[model samples]
Target: MRSKESDQTKEGSPSIVDSRFTQTLRNVQGLLKGRSFPGKVLITRLSGQLDESSIPPPAYLRSFSDSDVGPIELDNTFEDGFQSRSNSNASSSSSKMRTLSNTEAMSDQVQKSTMGARAIDSARLMKFTKELSTTTVILERLRELAWSGVPHQIRPKVWRLLLGYAPPNSDRRDGILRRKRQEYLDCAAQYYDISDMDRTDEEISMLHQIAVDCPRTVPDVAFFQQAEVQKSLERILYTWAIRHPASGYVQGINDLATPFLVVFLSEYLEGNVDGWSVADLPPSTISDVEADCYWCLSKLLDGMQDHYTFAQPGIQRLVFKLKELVRRIDERVSTHMEEQGLEFLQFAFRWFNCLLIREIPFHLVTRLWDTYIAEGDALPDFLVYISASFLLTWSDELLKLDFPEMVMFLQHLPTQSWSHIELEMVLSRAYMWHTMFNNSPSHLVN
Candidate 1:
């Protein structure tokens, strides 16, 4: 009897499957007849199971709703690919169909959204080009553009101009860069080319510190690890330290020079900069890149010299200000932190020390600096607000964690995967907070 029942089950299984397939085909044909999609759709299955990973979440679809493109209609042929089933299987098949529909919609939206972003980027590039094309650049107009963001292609030139390393006047720019580049080479020879045996203990220590930090700087980036890139960084940092006795090769300053190096090197290389090797460039070109990076780094550090001097008083002061600022903005998070014995300096010191370079991904660093450089001398003050904004961005999550957990989380902020969008949001909040606090300083005071 058991053998006869087993035989019956096997004999009935194919009919049941065929019936479901026929029903699904009818449903798909109905859908296709009702819709006007003009393409053949092919769907194949290796097994009966569906790959859930292939389907995007509903939230992902909503994220791109603001794209300039019109709503994408579901392709009838694509919908026709899934066969229906009976009972619970029927429900599962319907969900699979919906997921496939959503997947295609999301793909369309993402493509359109990317196209829109590229269009905007191209427009921005054109604007920068037009502004830079003039014999004498309008500094004010250039600052306004640079504040929003600089195009990667023109960022090398824009950063120099913004930092006052390169002149705003086009004709003078070439002559000035030539002289400055040569001047940098001379400075390197005078200060950096010396043997360790001839150097003072302090000079030797600083050189050693820079050497130690060079490979450690942006370690995740393959570009920085290259022998040539590390040497360029060492020369740039050592020379800047020698020139600026007030803040001689501070640990975090190594991180600061990275943005300049990447930007300057960008002029000589293209595509994924992280993969580029400095060895590919001619020595003269490399020398020029190093010179530009040195000058720009110098210009950047000049504003916040005290931040790295002696005990880094500027950083201490900024951290204190950040604590106060957060207290005013989100007193709950502030009070909770104090109650938990958490100090802003514990985490924020690195943020200020590295200009949040250590906190964010390397790619977004240059974009963040666009606004920073645009702020000019105000960067130091503006930076405190930026730090406060950055800290408060994780307030909700931070509130949930205990002191030790908070410290660990902040020390290793989950920003390794952050993109330009997240970075822009931080900058936007910082700008808003800066504007609010500057106008009403009393709110920030005890």
Candidate 2:
């Protein structure tokens, strides 16, 4: 089989005029190829025109109720206490995102520009450490605190505790880390040795894909741009893939590994790890981070392993659910999308697969993960609701566009300026939506 990366190399760089068209086509191709449907004709229908009479009644129309779910009440003391921006106009609406409180006394635009690296709150940091030390692990309390946002400095240790990677017993912590880190290094010594001549064809192919994807994983991050950093990523991804042959080496898994890598790497750094150069770090420090990341990422993926399995059942179910959820939540947007012949998979596949890693900034992504791990095994189910709410966050803007424009808008949202505060708002709204509608059956009537 021809490799995906090799196909790109042979085509060379696409011209500016056809780039968007070429890119969108490639995206569609990848979606269809990655998934397994009955036939080629059935799959090709994804991009074809939708005839009104042929469209099935939306899944939610027959199932869910139109009754009002009560308004969401947010806590006032939550980090960067945010007020949801409201706009009556359509075109300017997506701009109406979560912003700092009025008492902050600055415009949202101004706040965005001036916001730098988030500072760790000493009280919260102390509180988290104390809670972690307690004999009885109060998970509900931890989830509440984590939902607000983990302090940046303590996030690495906090994540380990939250994910069950660290023991509840403090006495056993050092021994566990020592054993796990060495286990990873030993695996690397055996399987990841590039010098080995006996590497199988599948192993070679997996490594090639990892190498091609490593630099592209988090292109904007200065930390990920270094050759050494990319090699660390390569080892983690390749090692994980080789071990888990069932879901081996999916494209989006590469994106999923970065948050763990960065967060774990921060544990060893003196100051903000964002500005610290990877080349300046010792090889052992890098190896320790790689080991920790491998284990934590394994924990994360374990819940949603079906997502990257044969045909990605988890994503398929999610896109279907997202369509149904949107139909019930926002009829206009759903109707508009149906009229445009849009399948939820086109925009939503990456959303489910990567846990919105590609959509949000890295710092914010870690904060999001803090809540995800805290939420326990239900992350996959809850993410469908989050993805639905995230899509509708731009409903006003999406309602204004045509087919191609809507696709482009949904793919690259106006999230360039989104910070931890904005992320908190999105997650908060999603939690409300999930609570209200998740259990309401499609057969129920208002």
Candidate 3:
């Protein structure tokens, strides 16, 4: 909870000690580059355990026969503290990004089976259902699966569970969704049904702004470009704004809606449906997607309402924290940015406001959200670190630029085509940094 600025100032003068520690950390990080390990092994090694048993296998020994697939023994010290099930028996084609990275990146390609649509691991779903039945362990299990990225077929159900939109009780879930979906539709009707005389000036203003911003939300995506889709987004934003009143209809809120909309809609698709037209889907299906999106967006914003509230104090604090953390982690980059009169606010506002939605591709954003939504209330705080890692990922490119060029570079960082690989790298680096400096004292002085 300590501020990064205070941490730096408190470090006082430990230049030699700090340099030694930083170098040692960097050396370890260099050793880890492109080498994947079990979560426990990776965290133990990163935490400064360099013993032979703790060190990961050498590069040459990493190759395994395809027949070597088996259950992975996970270290309990992992982020969510759940043992992962090996997906070797699952068909590789059904495997979404979750299974792709979970098996490939976590176990170092030991399990490469595919999962057909609606064919997510039976054992996993059973465990999830059983856990939810207990009530006490539901959130924990949800976090585990969500952090690793939920399987595509289960994402809608998983999302509802995580956001508290659907009842945790399986038997009650359908009824809850039906009721909530109806509530959303009713809310939409109320907002849209207003005659000119029934609407207030502020309501009119908010709807107009939502209407204008809807087309601009995800303009490149064909689904969002549809007239019906645009109208849904407008209604969702307007309904949310009217409900919240204090932080109604911000530009970036539109960005937050896309991930929810896309994820909910994916439940109905077979595979890789990013380019599919929503217009091809039934009206009821589209309404269901929009309703789910509206509610999920509401759930997300509830925790960070201040971010969109007047003056955006939440984003300001986050931007400040990112700057502070960056200065501690990479003083040279920090100083270079300062010399160019650049502030974190200039670039990080979009990062915070939109949760980096605009910066990354949509598919990868959903992958990233697996971890984000899993983190729950910690999302706003975790984002500060993720934003710092993302910015510093381009430190070399950023340091070379002047003020104008740096601004442009920060705005468009060659991430348009980034896939799960790039996203995993960024998240991994951020996780490392978070473990090292989140609440700990910075060894180095900036």
- lDDT by residue (203-306, candidate 1, tens digit) is 99889888998999998888888988899999999999889887777899899998988888888788887679777689999999999999999998888889
lDDT of 2: 0.70
Model 1 backbone overlap count: 0
Model 1 TM-score, 2 decimals: 0.78
lDDT of 2 by residue, 103-177 (tens): 353454344433321122444566677787787567666665675567666778777777778776777888999
lDDT for each residue of candidate 3 in 1-446, tens digit (9 for 90 to 100): 67868645644456423654455455555654654322212333233425576445543121111111223434433322222335435545554444555544654422333332123455545645566566444676677656655656566777777877777677777888888889988988888767857899878877888888888887767777878778878878888888888887888898889889888877776656546667678988888888899888888888899999989999999998888888877787888999999988998998999999889877677777877887888889889878987888788788899999999988888998765555655666677677666657543234
Please, what is the whole-model Cα lDDT of each candidate in the order they appear? 0.75, 0.70, 0.71
The full ranking of all candidates by TM-score, starting with the best, is: 1, 3, 2
Which 10-residue window in model 1 sums to the lowest lDDT?
60-69
For model 3, which pairs clash? 91-113, 91-114, 91-115, 92-113, 92-114, 93-114, 94-115, 94-116, 95-115
Candidate that would win on TM-score: 1
Q: Is candidate 1 or 2 superior in TM-score?
A: 1
What TM-score would you give candidate 2 relative to the actual structure? 0.72
Q: Give the per-residue Cα lDDT of candidate 2 at 411.
A: 84
